[model samples]
Target: MGEQKVKTLAGDELKAIKEAGSGKKKSRKTTSGQIYISSSYNNTIITITDDKGNVLTWGSSGMVGFRGSKKSTPFAAQRTMEEMLKAMKGIGITEVDIFIKGIGTGRESAVRALNGSGIKVRMIQDRTPIPHGGVRKKKPRRV
Candidate 1:
């Protein structure tokens, strides 16, 4: 009969294996980032990005378990910001510039939440689109 060999890892190797399997991989450390808050009539989404505009993480009211009309509420936006800040903090993001879009009820609350989370906001810019002249009006309907 052929001989069979069983191999086992050392204690340190087993510990490393366990640690790797625990799902706490180290994330890239970033000091400053950009926060994009899009608050529409139906939902509010917050995205964390690097200074160069590379998204690191994002969260939305819908992602935070809000549904229907609740998704657009200020409270839901606040909660979503809290969740996003918690995640961003893990990656060492302490300062940010806020860019806001849309005109939903959650807009201001989300900004307040971000500030309250201990992140230093450098600037807040409104990116909501405004029509300069808008499209041409439709022609009169025939009688």
Candidate 2:
């Protein structure tokens, strides 16, 4: 084998690719959307999306530089929500239906933060999954 062949696109294809990749994403006018709060034992993540599930923005305690157990604390969650709300506001999100999906210590606090942000809360739904006694119990420890 000597030289390898290089692949190239036509001028129109190249121009289309450049136009598609060069511009920043277009922001739409969204007045109401959905908020997903995922609070876990180690962290809290808040994601805001349009009604159609297109994520507008998100923030986490870890994103705010919280480390270790601090990332799971209510204060951390509140702060994370505050950061997320700032982004949401710029997107014109003034009303939301919250769907929380965890039982971490920060769960409620994060909602409170959003409520205090003056955005109308259309609904709060807990999407946490509950066990229906499916897993077998472990053997009891003996002395």
Worst 10 residues of 2 by lDDT: 20-29
The 0-to-1 C-alpha lDDT of every candidate, in the order given, reads 0.92, 0.92
Q: Pick the lDDT winner.
A: 2
Q: Against the correct fold, how does model 1 do in TM-score?
A: 0.77
Q: Write the per-residue lDDT of candidate 2 for residues 16-129, one digit (tens) a residue.
A: 999988868888789999999999999999999999999888889999989998999999999999999889878998889999998899999999988888999999999999
lDDT of 1 at 42: 94
Instruction: Rate residue 41 of model 1 by lDDT.
Output: 93
TM-score of each model, in listed order: 0.77, 0.84
